[model samples]
Target: MNKQIALHPDLDDDLLDVMEPDNGGSVSDELSRNLRALWSTFYRNRLLIAAIVGVFMLIGLGVTMLMTPKYRATTSIQIDQQSTNVLGNTDQNSVDPAAAWQDADRFLQTQVDVLQSRAMAITVMQDLNLNANDDFIHQMGGKPADRPAGPLSLADTKREQILNVLSDGLRVDLPRNSRVADISFTSPDPRLAARVANAFAADFMIFNMKRKFGSSTYARNFLESQLSDTRSKLEQSERALLDYARSAQLLDVSGGIASSTDGSTTGTPRSLTTSNLVQINDAYAQAQAARVQAQQHWEQAAATPPMQLQEVLTNPAVMQLAQLKAQAQAAYQQDLQRHKPDYPQMQQAAAHIAELDRQLNSLATSIRGSIKEQYATALKQEQALSGQVNGLKSSTQNEQSRSVEYNILKRAVDTNRTMYDSLLQRYAEVSAQAGVAANNISQVDVADTPDKPVSPKPLINLALAMILGMMAAAGFVLLRDKFDDSVRTPEDVNSKLGLTFLNSTPMLDQEMTPDEALSDPRSALSEAYSALRTSIELSHKGGAPRTLAVTSTRQSEGKSTSAFAIARNFAKIGRSVVLIDGDLRKPSLHRLANVPNGRGFSNLLARMGSIDEAIQPTETPNLSLISAGPLPPNPAELLSGARLPELINELAERFDVVVIDAPPVLGLADTVLIGSTTEATLFVVEANGSHHGHAKTAVRRLTGNGITIIGALLTKYDARKIGYGYGYGYNYTYSYSYGQPDAPSSSRKWPWSKK
Candidate 1:
C-alpha cells in the first residue's frame, strides 16, 4: 500500500505538471487543439459580449437624443480679378493691374483670412449686440471666469473670451478654382445664424470702403496744414521786406523774387527794374574780375626779383652775355696764376674779362628799367579796373538795396505759391474721391434662414455606438479569458494538470441519477462511460485496474456521479462492480440511490456493523453500492484506520472492479487516504467548476501520498459547445487519428499519447 500522507489542495504551486510533455504529436493536432480551446472561450463568454454591446448602444442613443442642434448659414461674395482703388491716384507707385490679376487667388485668400480674423469677429459681435443678448451670453457660458491678475481689466478679459466664442462659430471657405468666397456662421437659432452671416458680409464691404478711401481723408488734412503754414510764411516775408524798405528810405521795386499783389504770390517773371539791377550786377562782376587780375599781376611785380620775372627770364641777349662774362673772368684768373701779372697773355685775358663785365652791367641796367616800366603799366591797369567797378557799384546802389529785400520776398512768395498750388490740387482730388462712394468688394448674396439643424444625427451615432460596443465586448472577453485560472477546456486540464485524458462524459440530465443513465446502454451518456471504462482497463500494463478511486478538488464537482457511472457501465458489460461511498464527511451516495445511509462505511469503520450490512444493492444491474453509512465525527480518522484498506481489498476480491467515491482533496485528507489504498486514481474534473490551482493542488495531494493517478475524467463535457467535435460519432469519439498509424485511433489518445 502507498504511504498515508497529509496535504492540502491550495498550499502548493509547484505540484502542477510534474510530467513533461512528450516529444510527440504532429503540428496539425496541436493546431486543432488550440482552435478548439479558443472556440470554448468564445462560447462561454458569449453572454458577456452581448451585454456590453447592448449597454453601449443605449448610451449612444441617449447622447444623440440630448445633444443640442445648430444651424449653419453661408453668404457668398464675388472676388473680382482686379481690385479698383476708389482713393485718388495720389500714390506714386501703384500696383500694376495686370500683376494683381495674375495673383487673384492670393487676393481671394487674403479676403478669406480677413473674414476669419478675430478683429472681424469682434466687429460682428458688436454689430449683433451679442454681449447683452441673454441667449447668446448664456449659451457661450453664463458667467465670466475670475480674471487673472494681469495687464487686462475684467471687462477686457471678458471681451476676449466673447471674441473667441464668436470666432468659433465663424468659417470662411474659398470654393475650388472659383473667384467667389463663402462666409459662414453657426448659431442655435436659424434666423440668428442668417442675420449674423449677412451682417458680416455687409460689414466687410463697409470696412473695404474705408480702406480704399482712407487716403482721401489723409490728403484733406495734409493740404489744410500746408496751406496754413504757407499763408503765414508769405505774410512774414512781405512784412519783413516792407520794414527794411522803409528803414532804408528806398523806393519799392516793381517786382520781388516773385510778383505778388494783396500778399498773394505765384511763380512768375520779374519786372523791368529787377532786370536792370541784374544787368548792373553782371557788369560789376566782370569789372571786379578784371580788377582782380590787374591786382594779382601788380603784387607779383613788386614782391618778386626781376630775374625771376617771365619778362626778364625770357630775354635771350641777357642770358648769352652773362654766360660769356663768366667764361672770360675764369680765363683771366687761370693766366694770372700761371705767369706774372705784367705778362702780355695775362693782360689780354684781364682786358677781355673787363669788357665782358662792362657789357653784363649794361644789360642788367636795361632789365631793371624794363621791370620798373612793366610795374607802372600793371599799376595803371589795376586802378582803371577798380574805378570802373566802383562806378558800377555806386550807380546800382538803390536797385541793389531794393533787390536784397526783393529777392528774399520773391523766393518766399514763390515757394509758398508752388506749395499752395500743389496742395490745393491734391485737396480737390481727395474731396472728389471721397464723394465717389464706391468700394472694390461688394456682397454678392445674403444668407437665408436654414430649415434643418446640423447636429444630433441619430442614425450615425447609433451605428458608431454599435461598432464601439462590439469592440469593447471582444476586448473584455479576451481579457477575462486570458486572466482566468480555471480549467474550462480539455486541452487546458490535460496540459496544465499533466494527466492522461481517458474519456470525456457528456453532461447528463440533472433530473436523472447515474443508475438511471445505466438503463440505456446505447445512450451517449452510456457510451461515454463505456469508453471511460475501456480506457481504465487498457491504462495498466498487466490488465484492467481492479480498484479505481474518483475524486476532485472540491465538493459538488460531480465526482460521485462520474465514478458511479463508470462502475455502473462496467457492470452493464458483464463485470461485477461494487461502488463504495468513501466520502464519509459529505456523502451523497445514499441520497442519489434512494438507499438508507444507516450501517455503512462509518458504522463498519467503528465496528458497529458487519461488512455484509454495510454493503447494499443498487437498481443498476450487476452493480452493488455502499453508502457513507453515517456522518462520522472525524472522517479523516476513520479513513486512516488500518481496517479501511483491508476492507477495500476485500471488496476488490468480491468484484472485478471497485469504484470508490473519495472526499475532495482541497480541505481534507479523505481523498488522499482512499487514493493510496486504491489500485489506480481517476481525478474527476468538472468542465468549468475546477480551477487550475485547485486541480493542481488536489493532484499533488494524492500524488504526495504515493497514489498513482491512472487518468483524468472530464465530467459534464459539452462537445457541441467547445467546437472540438459534435455528435456521438467518428469525430467526438474518434478524432485522435491525424494520419499517425500508431495513434490510439480515438479521442482517448489525444491528451495522453506518449509517442
Candidate 2:
C-alpha cells in the first residue's frame, strides 16, 4: 500500500508534474538555434556558397564519368559451429577429448577464417582459370610473363600473382550478432564475379562435409569394439543384481514379492507394519477432530451467562417458569394501575410473580449441570485417542529400524538396472549415427548474377558532395566573421564598446570629385554627414558643444575627413564653423584643399604669425580652414604652449562653432592637449577597421584628462559586409550613389593588409 500525501487539498497534482524542465524540449530548442545561425550565414554568402557547391558537384560528375565501375556478386552461407554432433565420443579410451568440436567463439571465428584463407583463394583462382587472363594478371600489378626475381620458379611466382588477384577482388562481410556471412567478389566482368563467389561457398561446404564424414568413419570403428564390451558388462551387472535380490528375499525377478508356501506375511515387514500404523493414525485423527468439535461446543456454553445460554433458554421447565413469571408480572402491573397497594388483588399478583422467579432459577441450574457432563465426556475421548496415536508412532519407528538392510539390497538392484538401460540407449544412438554423415554448415543463398555495377552511385555521391561542400564553405564564412575584429556596424561602436552612435559615413567612388560627393545635399555622403552634424549638435544635454575636438585612436581612420565633413555640414546649415588641422606631423587638410601650408597654425602658435592670416576661407558658405603651419621641429612642444588655449578661445569667438581636427589620440599628446582646452571631444571609429580595445582606451584617455566625450562616430560602414541587409534599410552603394549606381571598394583602414 502506498501512502498518499496532499500538498494542497484543492490543488491538482498534475500542476506540480508540469514544473520540471523537459530535456526533449531543450534539445529541440538548441537544434533550432544552430540551424537558424547556419541559415543566416549561408544567406549572407549565397553567391559564394553556390560557387563552391557547384565546383564540388562538377568534380563528383567527373569522378563518376572517368572512374572505372566495378560489379559485386555476393554469396551467403550459415556456419553453425554450435550444432556439433552429439554422439561424437569424448571418452579417454575412445577419442582424445581435447580434439572434441565445441560451439565456442573460437570455433565460429575459425570457420570464417577458412572462408577468407589464401588456400581458398588458390582454389577459386584455379577454378576460374584466371592465370590465362592477361587482364587479371595486369590488375595485380604485373605482366603475364613477369615474375619476381628471386630463388623461386616462374610457375611459383605466377601462382602467387593469381592468388593476389583473387584476394584483392574478394570482399568478405560479417554482419554483427549473426553466424551468417557474405562472400562477395568484385570485377570488371559481372559474370566472373558471380562465378567466383558461388565457387567459394560451394568449396567451403564440401570441405566441411568431408570433416563430418571422417568423424563418422572414426566413430563407426570405435563404437563396434566398445558395444561388445558394454553388452557383456550389462549382462554381468544384471546377473549380480538378481542373485542379491533372491538371497535377501526382498525382491522377485517376476515383478512380485517372494512368498513362503504356507502364505505367511512376507513381502516387506516394514511396509506391512507401516500400513497398520497408517490405519491407526487415520482413526486417531478422526477421534481428535470429533473431540475438538465437542470441546468447542462446551466452551461456548460455559462461557455464556445462564440467562443468555441457548440450552438454558430452550429448556421446557425454564420456558414454562419464565412464561408464568411474565404473566404474573403483567397481572401485578395491571393491579398497580387500577387499585391501591393494600388491595387484595395487588398482593396476590406480587406473590405469584415471586414464586415463578424461584422456579426459573432452579431450572437454569439443572441445564448448566447437564452441559458440564457433556464437556467431561468429550475431553476423556480426546485423551484416549492421543494415547493410541503415540503407541502406534513408537511401533512404526521400530519397524523402520529392522528394514535398513533390506532397503540397501533393493537400492543396489535399482541402480544397476538404471545404468544398464542408459548404456543401451546411448549405444543405439551412436550405432545409427555411424551409418549416416550429417553436417551443421549449409549454403543458404547462392551468389546471384548482378544486373548493374555497385560502385559509382552518382546520385548519392552528388548529394553528399553538396552537403559537405556547403558545410566547408559555411565554416569558412563563419570563421572569417569570428576572426575579423574591425567594427563593421554601428552596434560595434555603441553597444560593444559602450558609447553613443553618431553616424556611419559612406565611401564614394574614387573617380568622383570630393566636392560633389561631400557637399551635394541629396547624395548619401552628404546626407550621412548631415545626420552626423545633427547628432553632434544633440550631444550636449543642454545644447550643442561650442568648441569640440575631433580625433581618432590611430591614423587613416578618416578622423580629419570626418571633422571637415561635420564643419561643412554645419556651414550648410548657416553656422560659421572654423576647421583647424592640429596634426603638425602629417597635415592632410592643406593637401586636400590645394591651399598653401607655409604659414598656418605652427607660425601662429610660435608667435610669428597673425591668427587672421593663418585662417583661410572654404568653398562652403560659413566654413574656414586653418591648415597645420609648416611642420614644426617640435610639434608636441608647440601645441603644449599656453597660447594654444588662447588661440582656440579667439577662434571660438570669431566663429559660431570651432571644429579642430586634432591628431590621433593614441601614442600622441596632441589630441589630449587640444581636447583639454575644448568644450568637448568626438572620437572617430572606422567601421570594421578600428579595434574595439583601441576605441575604448581612447575614450578613457580623453575622459581621464577632464575632457568631455560627447560620443563616437562610425565611419566607412558597409551594410552588406556585416549581414545587415534586411535589418538595415540601405546598402553601401545605394546609400552613397550620386545619380549613378556602382558598388565601391571599402575605404576603411586595412591595417593587416598594409605594408
Candidate 3:
C-alpha cells in the first residue's frame, strides 16, 4: 500500500509562481531550454557515446600499430632568377625588380615541376641504377625484374614499374617568396630515401647543364649556316657593282674635282664626267665675259674715225707721230712766212709734215686692225667653250642613268656586308662558349638519413579518431531528434504541439496501480496532478476553470485516468468536483470509479434520466462520477445535439469543477462535441507514446471548432527518457515518505549507470 499525506484545501501559490518564467518565453530562456535539452540527450546516452569513442580510439591504435612507418628525406636546391652571362653582355636598362621577382617566382615553380617530372625521375633512376639494385628496389617495395622470354619486353615492364614507384615517392615543394625548392622522397628505408633524394638533386644539375650545352650548340650551328649564306650574298653583290661600273664607263674621280684652263679648281662633282663638265662650264662663262669686252672695243674702233679711236688716240707711237707732225707744221708755217713759194728750208719742213701725217695714218690703221683681231679671237674662244659644255652635258645625262643600277647594287653590297659581320660575330661567340655551361641551379642542402619515421603517429591518430567519433555521435543524435517528433515532455507539449504546457505526470510504477498511486497524495502521480491543478489555476485570472474536458489524440493515452486525478485533486482543495465519462463508444470512468453504470452522461443527454439519477458519488470526498450510461449507435450524432450542453450546465451548477473524459479526437467527432459543452479542454499526451502530428492535428480540430483548450498534461512521463524532468523544476522521483528515506526505487538500470 502507498503512503498517503494529509490533503490541503488551499492551492500551492509557490508552484504557480515557479511557472511564471515559462510564460515569459524570453530569448534567453528559450536558449537555455534548448541547451539543457541537448545536454540531457547527451547525458542520457553518455555510456553509448563513450563506447563509440572508445571503439574508434581502439581502432586508431590498432591501425597505427599495424601500419608500416615511412621515412622522408628532403634535399633543398636553390634556383636563381637570372643565370650567369658567359658572353659578357649585360643590359642594364632591361633589369626591373618587380619583373625579375615575378620571373623568379615562375622559374622556381617551373624548377619544382621539373624536379617532379617523369624524365627527371628516369634520370635519377638511371644514375642510381635503382632498377638493377635489388636492395633499393626491395626497400621501395618493388620486385626485381624477371627475365622473361622477351628480354626487351621484360626490361620495359620493369622500367615502367620502377617509374611508378619513384613517382609515388617523390615530392617537390617551393613556397611563395622563396627561391629554394625542397625535393623529398619517402621510403621504408631511411638510407634509400636519402640516397634517392641526393641522386635526384645531382642528376637534376647535370641535366640542366646538358640542356644549356645543347642550346649553345644549336645556336652555333644556326649562326654558321646564316653566316655562309650572308657571305655568298655579299660576294655576289660586290661582283655585280664592279661589273656595272665597268660596263657603263662610269668613273669616280679621286676628289670629284678637276682643274680649269685658267688654273683654278671647280666644285666637286658626282663622277669623272661631271667633274669635266663643271670645269668646262666655268671656262665658258669666263670666255663669254672676255668676248663681250673685246666686241665693245672693236665696235668703238670700227664706228669711230681711226684718229678718234681711244686705242689709236691713247697709243704712245701715235702720240709721238702726232707731236712730230705738230712741230713740222709749226716749222712749215714759219718757213712759209719767210720764203715765198719753194724755199729749200720751207720745202724740207713741208715734206717732213707730209711724212709725219702719213705715219699717223699708218699707226691708226694698225691700231684698228689689232682691235678686229682681238674680237675675232674672243669670239672663237667663246664658241669653243660652248661646244665643250654641250658635249659634257650629254655625257653627264648618260652617266646619271647608269648610276641608278649602280646604286642598287651598292646598297645590296652594304646590306650583305653588315649581315655577314653580324653572323660572323655571333658564330664566334657561340663557338667560344659552347663548352661552358652556366647552370643557374645549385644544391643548397643534401638530404641525410632520417632519424625517425614521419608517419603512423599514435597520439595524433588517436586524437583524430576521438574527434571523428564525437562528430559522428553528434550527427546521430541530431538525426534521431529530427525524425523522432514524439511528445515526451512538457517542453514537447509546448514546442511540438504548440499547446500550453501545464505539468508533467510521471508514469506509475509497474507494480503499483493507478488507483493506489492517486489515493496516496504523497506519490509522484498525485503531486504532478496537484501541480497540474495549480498551473491551470494560474492560467486563468478567475482561478481554475469551472468545466473542463479531458481528451487525447488516441486511446490508451491515460485521458480517463488524468480526468479522474484532476477531479480528485480539485476535490482536495475543498471544491465539489464531478468526473464525467463522455466516451459514448467506450466508457472508462465507471471502471476507474468502481461504480455501477446504471445511468450517466449519455442517459442524461438522451433525456432517459434526470441529472440526480446520472450523477454518482465517488469514494473520495467532495468528488462525483458520471459514467457513460450506454454505448450509442451513433456517438457523434448523439453528442452533436443540444441536450449535451444542457446536461453540462446542470453538472456545472452542482460541482465547482466538471472534468469530462471524452473520446479521442481522431476518427471521431464525439470529443469535439463533448468538449464544446465545457468551458475548457485539457489535452492529455502520452510521453514517448503520442505522435506529434496526431496530437497537433487533434488540437487543430478542437480549436477549429471554437473549443477552448486550457493546457496540456503530459501523462506517463519518464524522467530518464528526457533527462530528469526537462528542467521543469519538479523532481519526478522524489517521494514525501517522511519515515522511509532509503526505500528502494523502481527504475531501469544499465551496466554503466551510477548508484
Candidate 4:
C-alpha cells in the first residue's frame, strides 16, 4: 500500500544535485571552499575583530603619548689610513692600491673600534667633566655617587658610573671604502647630546696626535740612547787603536788611514820605516845612475878613448883644448915639411905649436883627473844610500808584523764611527720631525644641537598598532573556527560527516510549538520540512521509501519534532502518513501530535496490543500516530524481537508513508533496531547542538546495523549563530498577513527574522 510521490516538474534539478552527497574534490576546490568558510567566519565575527582592533589602537596611542623623547646628535670625522708624511716619503705612496685599500679598511675599522672604546669614552668624559657634573649625570639616567664603600673610593666609583653612562649613549659607524666615521650621542637635552658628540670627535683626534707624538718621542729617546752608546764605543775604539800603535812602535807616516765604503778599514796608517825606505831607495837609484856615467867617462879617458865619451865630447873646455891642439899639429906639420926642427921662421910656428901641445896635455890630464874624482864620489854616495835602504827595509818588514792587531783595532774604530754618524743623523731627523704635527685624523664637521627629538612618533606607532591588532584578530577568529566542529550548514553536512544534505529547518520561536508551526502552511519550518520531504522522495529510485525512521544522536535535538513535521507535511500533500513513536525509552510523538500515549509501537512489539488498536488518528487530514504505550523495563529486548519488523511491515501496508519517531541512536540500541525494520532512516542533527563526532558515530551505528540512511536534516538552524555564506539565503521570515493571498511575500522584511 506504499505509494511513491512523483517528482514535481517545477523542482530544480541543479539544486537537487547540489544537495546530494559530495565525493572528494580537487585541491583547488577544497582550498576555495576553505577560503569561503574563513571569510564567512570572519564576517560573522566582524564586531569582535573591530573591538579588539580598537582596543589595541587605543593602547598604542596612549603609549606613544606617554613616552619620553630623546635627542640625537652626530659628528663626522675623517680617519686616514696613514698619517701625513711631512717629509714626503715615497715608500708610502708606492703601496699597491688593493693592498692600500685593504690596509685602509682595517685601519678605518680599528678607528671605529677605538672611538667606541672605554678608554676613549673616559677621555671624552674627562674633557667634558661629565663625571663631576651631577645634573648631567642625572639627566643621562645615572644616580649621583654615594660615599666611599668597600674597595672603591667615591671618586673611583663615580668615574666608573659615569664611564658606563658614556658607553651606553655612544655609537660609532664607519662606511665601506670610506675614511669618514660618524660619532653619535643620545640624550634628553639637545645641547648635552651635541656637546658629547663633539667632545668625542675632538678627543679622538687629539688622542691620535698624542699617540703619534709619543711614538716620535720614543724614537728620539731611543736614538739618543744609541747615540750615546756609539759615542762611547767610537772613543773606546780610537783609544785602543792609538794604544796598539804606540805599544807596537808602528808609527804612521801617513797621518790618517783610509776607509772603504763598507765601513771597514783598508789598512793601518803607513809606518815611518816603510816611508823612509821608499825615499832612500829612490835616491840610491839616482845615485847609481850618476856613478855609472862618471865611471864611463873616466874609463874612456884612461883607455885613451876619453874623447869618445859623451861627456868628454860635449865638454866645452875639452873641445877648446882639442881644437888648439889640432891647430898646433897643423902648423908643426907644415914646418916639418919645409925644414928640420929648429928653423928660424918655422921656429916661431913650431914654438906656437909646442906651446899649444904643452897646454893641451896639461888640460887633458886635469880633465881626466876631475872625471875620476867625480866617479869615486858618486860611487861612495851610492854605497851610502844603498846601506840606508837596506836598513829601512828590515825595519819596515818588522813593523808590518805588528800592524795586524793595529788593523783590527782600526776597523773597530771605523765601524763605531760609522754607526755613530748614522745615529747622530737619525737623531737630528727625528728631532726635526718631532715638532711637525702631521695628524691624519681630523674633524670634518662639528655636531650641532638638534632642533627636533627623534622618538615617540605617533603615525608610526599607530600603523604598527593596526598591523598587530589585525594579526591578533585573525589568529583569534581562526582558532575559534578551528575548534568549533558543529554541523551548521549544507557544506558542513558534506565536509564534516560526508552525508547527503536534505534541507535545513529554521529554529522556531519559543512561543510557537511544533504542532502550531506545522499547522501553518506558510511557516518557514513547514517549508524546510517540505523541501526535506522532496529530497527524501527523490532520494529513492522509485520515489519516497515506503517506511522511514527519524532519529538523532542526542535527546531534545528536535528529532520527534522533525518526525512529526515530516509526517504532517506528507499528509498535507494528500499522502496517508502514519507517525510511530519508536522510542521505547522516551516517546515524544504523542506529545508533539497532542494525543495520548496509552498504547503505541512498544506495546505491539511486546505482544500486548494489536496494530489496529495502536493506530490513532491525528488532527491533520491524512496523518495518524502510534505512541509508546508505557515505559518498558527492557525496551532493547522488545525492539530486538521479530515483532518490530512485522509491525513496521504492517504499518507500511496501512499507510502510504510510514514515519518512525525513533529515540537517540548514541547510547541505545532501540533506534537502530527500529530503523533496521524501516525502509530507510533520516538522520536529524541540531545545528550548533550535536557534536560532529557524536552525529557521525550515530550515523555509523545505524548504517552498521544494516539500516538504510537516506540523508541528514539539520534542525534548529540559526544563520546568525553560524556563518551565512554557503549560498544559503539571508535570514528572512515568512510574512503572512491576515486575509491576504496565501502566497508568501517577496518584499516584506525584518532584521531579526530567519529563513
Candidate 5:
C-alpha cells in the first residue's frame, strides 16, 4: 500500500515566518537587498568607474608635477648677563642674576622688533649696497628701471617687504623656563638665509649696547653740568653771607653777647672785662637809641594824616559834591554877571550850594576815619621794630660761629667732587670694554643648499583640474541618465510591474525572419526565446499552461514579433504552435509570419470564415499563423463577445500551444478581452523604449480583468550597450536542436533491413 500526505496551503507562509522575525527580518532583508542592488549597479557601470578613477589619478599626477620644494635652516641664541664695573658698588647688594636674565629676555624681544623695523632694514640695505645690485633688482621684478628713490618712501617699502619675508620664513620659539630661544628661517638660498639670520642677531646686540652706552653718557654729562651749577651757586651764596656779616661786625656776636651780659664765659678764654663790657654796653645802647629815634620818626610821619587830596579828587561822592559846588558857583557867577543876586537863577544856585556843602562834610568824615586807622597800625609796627633792633644787636656776636661749619662743608664738597671724577673715569673705561661686539646667538646646525624650488602650486592645480573634470563628467552622466526611461535589467522588468521575469531576450545586430530564427536556433535571440519558453512552462507548478497571450502597453513595442518568436520556438520543440493575430485594429502576425494579411481572428469571429480556413501554415513545419482577416469597425465589441472565449478554448484544445499577438493594453479593450480568455498573459517590454510606468499600467490593466499574468519578457534588449557588459545568453556559445523527426517511410519502417 502507498500513503500520501497533504500539506496546508499556509505552509509556505509558516516557513517564511520561521525563517525571519517580523520587523527585524523585513528591515535586515531590505537593507541587505538595497545594498546588493547598489553594488550591482556600481559593478554594472564599470566603464564609468574606471573613467572616474583615471580622472583622479591624472589630478594627482598634475599636482605632483606643479609643486615646489622648500628648504629650512635654524639658529639658536642664549641670553647671558655680563657683569660691569659701571654698575656701581651700590648695585652689588641689589643685583639678581635671575632678574637680570628676565630683563635680558625682554631686551632681546625688543631687539627682535628693532631688527624688523624700517630704520634697521635701511641700515642693512645701505651696508650691503643692495640698491645698485642688478641681481637683487631683477629678483624684485623692477617694473620701472629708472624709478626715482625717495628716502622715506623707499625705506618704508623695503622695511615692510623685509618684515613680511622674515615673518614668513623665520620662526622663533622660546623654551619654557629657559633663557635660550630657537630661531629658524626658510628660503630659496641656504647661505643667504643663514647670513641674514646671524646678521640680525649681531646687529640687535650692537644696537642695544650702543643705545645703552649713549644714553648713560648723555645722562652723566647732564648730571655733571647740574652739579657744577649747584656748587657755584652755593659758593656765591656763602661768600655774600660772609661779606655781610664781616661789614656789620656781626662775627663772634653770639659769644660776645654772652661775655658782655654774663660777665663769666665758659669755653672761651676771653672774658668780658669791665672796660670791654662798658664798650659793648655803649654800642648796644647807642644802637638802641638810633633804632628808637628812627622808629619815632617813622611813627610821627605815619601818624600824620595821609594825603587826602587824591581821595578828595577821585572819590565818587566827594567828586559829585565838588562838581555840584563848582556848578553852583558857576551858575551863581553867571547869574551875578547876568543879573542881581536876588534873580531866580541866582537863588537856585544858592540852594544847590547848600546841598553840596552837606555832602562834602559827610565825604570828609569817611576819609578822615580811614587815615586814622592806618596811622594807629603804623605806630604799633614801629614799637615792634624798635624791640627787634635791640635784640638783633645783642645777638650779632653769636652768629659768627657758623663760619667754621660752613668751611667744613666746603672741604667735604671738594672731596666728593674728586671721588665722583674718579668713578666717572672708571665708568667710561668699563663702558668701552662692554662695547666690544660678542655673539649673542650661535648656529646649532647649518642647512645644506637646496636643489629644488619650494612652490608653484603644481599639486594644487592638478587636484583642482581633476576635481572639475570629474564633476563635469558626472554632470553629463546624470543628465543623460535622468531623461532615459528604458528597462535595462531583469529587475527593471520584474519590479517595474510587480511580475515575475519570464525571460530576457537580448537584441541581435543581424536581422532574421521568424522562420530562419527557428531553424538556426543557436543564435542569441534563439537562446533568449528558449529561456522564455522555459520560464513560461515553469510558471504554474500544477500543470502546463495552454494559451499564452503576448501584449504591450503601447504600439510598435514588438509584441507581435515576440509572439511569433515564442510560437516558433515552441514549434521547434515538437509542440504544435499556432500564432494568432488578436490585434484586430492593427494586425501584425501575418506580416511577421510571411503569410497573407487577411482572414484571421476577426473573420472567424464575424462568421465570415471558419477557424481552420483562417489558420495558415508558415514556412516552418508545425508552426501556423492566423491573420487579422478583415478590418473590424468595433474591435472591442468583437473581442468582448462570447464567441471570442469559445474560439480561444477551442484553439487551446486543438494546438499544443497557442500564442496570441494581442493589441497594446492601454487605449484599447481588445487586449483586455483577449487576456480574459487566455491561460496566461506575457507582458512584452521593449528595452530602453517603453517607460517603466507604462509597463506597470499594462500589467495592472490585464490583472484587473481577471487575467492570469504569467510573467514578463524583455524584447529587443541590447545587452552590450546596457552599461556593463553582455547578458548571459551570449556569454558562451553552444549548439542544440529540438523537435522529433518525421516517421520513417513505410518501406524502411518494416524491419531493420538495408536497401
Candidate 6:
C-alpha cells in the first residue's frame, strides 16, 4: 500500500513558523531582536559558552596579574607667544595667518617626532643613568642580563612600540587657531611623568634656539663674505675704469670739444694732401700690377704639355735615328784624329749618318709645333697685369678719410669708467650695514630644573585593556555563531526542508519519566508538550490526523521518547490512543510503557494475529501500547509487505489516534516503508544533540519519497537551562493543581495554570 499522502498543498511556503512577526520596528528594535537572539543562543549553549568566556577571562586576568604594575605620570606646559620676541613687527612684516598656521602644524609635528626621537630618548636616558639602572626593565619582567649590549635600535617594530607609548602618554595639541601649544606627558610615576614632560619642553626650546642661532650665524658669515667680495670687485672695476679714462685723456673730453670748436675756424682746413694721395694711388697701382703678374705666372706653370705630340717625338724609331746621328758624329771626330777621309768604315758611317740626320730633322719639326701653343698663353698673362695695377690706385684715397672718426670713439669709452667708481664706493657702505643686521636668534628662555621623572604605564591602558577584552569576547561569539552548523531557530527547520515546525519545545536540563510528564499538565515541561499537541492539531488544517509516524535521521535522538511523550499527552487529554512500536529492529516503547516486549507488531504481522491481542493498555487511562515483538531479519521487507498497511488500517479503526514510532529515516528503509500507511509523519529532534543538517536530511528523505511530514517535535527540552519557564518546581505545581493528593493549594490557582 504505497499511498501518496500529500503533507499539505503548497509545501513550499513556511508552514511551521516559530519566528516572531515583524512589527514594523525601527533599527533599534532590530538590534534588540538580534541581541535577544544572541542571548537565547548563549542561554541554550550556556555551559559551553560560559566555559569559553571563562577561559578567556582567566587568561586575561592571569596576564593582568603577572604583568608588572607600571606607573605613569603627566605634566603640562603652556606655550606663550610672548615668551619669545617676534622677529619683525606685525605691522611692518605681518605673518600670514594661513602660512603661520601651516608653520604651527609643521612645528607641532616636528616636536612630536623630536620627543620620540632616539636622540632625545638617549639624552634623557643618559642624564638619568637609565642604561646603568635596570629598574624600569626589571619591573617590566626583563632582566639586566637580558638587555641588549648596545643602545636599542629604533627599527620599525621598536619604533611602533615607542610610538604607542608616546601616543598613550604624551600629548601636544594646540588650541584651535591659537598660537599656544599645550604639552603633556604621562609616566608610571606621577612626579617623573611631570618632570619628563617639562624636561621635553625645555629641551625642545633649547634645541630650537640653538638651531636658529646656528643657522643665522652661518647665513650671516656667508652673506658677509659675499658682501666683501662684491665690494672688492666693485672697487676694482671702478678703479680700472677710472684709470683707463684718465690714461686715455677722457677726463676733459668737453675741453677737447672746445679745442675742436676753436680749431674748426682757426686751424687750416685739413683736407687730404694731394701729393700724399697721388703717392698712395701709385703704390696701390704698383701692388696690383705685381699681384696680376704672380697670378699669370702660376697659371702658366700649371698647364699640361700636348700628350700626342710629345709621345711621337719620343718614339723608339726617332730615338734610334738620334742614336745613329750620335755615332756618326763620334766616328767623324775619330776619323779626324786617325783615318779621317779615306777609310771604308768611315765612308759607311758617313752614309748612315746622312740617313740619321734626315730622321732627326723630322722629329725637330714636331717639337716646334708643340712650342707654338705656349706663346699664346704668355701673351694673355702680360695683358691682364696692366689692368690690375690701375684699380689699386683708387682704393688708397678712401682709407685716409676714416682715420678721424676712430679717434673720437676711443675717448668716450674712458669717460664712463670714472663715473662707475664713485657709485661702487657708496654701495660698499650700505652692504656692511646689511651684513650686521643678519645676525639674529638669541635665547629667550632657558630650562629650569625638572621636578619629576616619567614613564612605565598609565591608567588609560587599564581602561583600554577592558575595552579590548570585551571586543575580543564579542568577536569570538560572532565567529562561533557563523560557523556553527547545528539547528538554532525554528525558522531553520522550516526554511531548510519546507516542513512545518509543530512546536519549539524549550530545552530541559535533566531527563523526566513518562509518568512524571503526564501526571502534571500545568508543569512547564507538560505545557511544552501541550503546545506540541496544539501545534500538531493546527497543522492538520481540518480533521485530526490519525496514524502519525514518529522518526528522525539517526538513533538516540529522542524520537521514541518524543513519540511516547506526545502519545501520553494525547491520552492525558482523554483521547483513545494506540502507541505502536513500528521500529521492528530496536523497540523501546515496551520499557517506557512497562509492557511486555514479546509478540508485538512483527509477531502480529507474521501470524496474522488480531490487533486486539497485540495491543495492551498502559497504566494511564485511554493509552494503549504495542511494542516491537521480535527483531525481524529484514525490517524493511516486513514493514513494506501487505500485512503492515492492513495492521495500520485495523488499528486506526479501533483507536481515535495511532502513534507509530518508526526507525531512523537515513540508515533504514523501514520508516519510509511504514510511512505509506501513516496519515502524517512527525520528526523529533533533540535540542543541541541532532545536527540541523541531519534533521533536514530526514525531512527531505521522507518528503522526497512522497511521505507526509506533518511537522517536527523538539524533545528532551531543558526549559530552565534555556531560560524558559520550566523545571521540577513547575512540575510540582502542575501535579498539585491537577488534584493529586499531596498537591499544594498555591499551585491550583496559579495565573499560568491551564483550563
lDDT of 5 by residue, 1-755 (tens): 01100111111222233224445456776785555444445555557856875777686776666543445555666654442334434635443333454476677666456555766655645555555444443333333234324654754555445445555565666675665666555665656556555555555555656654433465456656656766675566556545644554444334222243566433321322333554656655665565566566545545654334455557787877787789888778877877887878777778779878877866766675655565556556556655655565555455435445444444444455555576567556656554433333443544444445455456675667677766665665556555545566666665556766666555544445444554565554565576566556656554347888899889877788788888886887789988898888888777666788757888888877788889999987889888888888998888877898889888889999888999998888888888888888888887767764676677778888799888777776554454434223223122112232544434322110112
Candidate 2 residue pairs that clash: 486-688, 487-688
Lowest summed lDDT window (length 10), candidate 5: 1-10
lDDT tens digits, residues 67-124, model 2?
A: 6777899999887643444455554233223334544556667888888899888777
Assess every candidate by TM-score: 0.56, 0.46, 0.52, 0.54, 0.47, 0.49
Error at 566, model 1, angstroms: 1.6
lDDT of 1 by residue, 468-536 (tens): 998898888888877776765556666778787766666655665556655655444565666566666
TM-score of candidate 1 relative to the true fold: 0.56
Top candidate, metric TM-score: 1
State residue 744's C-alpha deviation in candidate 4, in Å: 15
* Residue pairs whose backbone atoms clash in candidate 3: none
Pick out the ten consecutive residues of candidate 6 with the lowest summed lDDT.
Answer: 1-10
Ranking by TM-score: 1, 4, 3, 6, 5, 2
Measured by TM-score, how close is model 3 to the native structure? 0.52
Best by lDDT: 3
RMSD of 4: 44.6
lDDT of 3 by residue, 331-445 (tens): 7777787796587777777778888888899889988999999999999999999999999999899888777777776667667877898889877667657634367789999
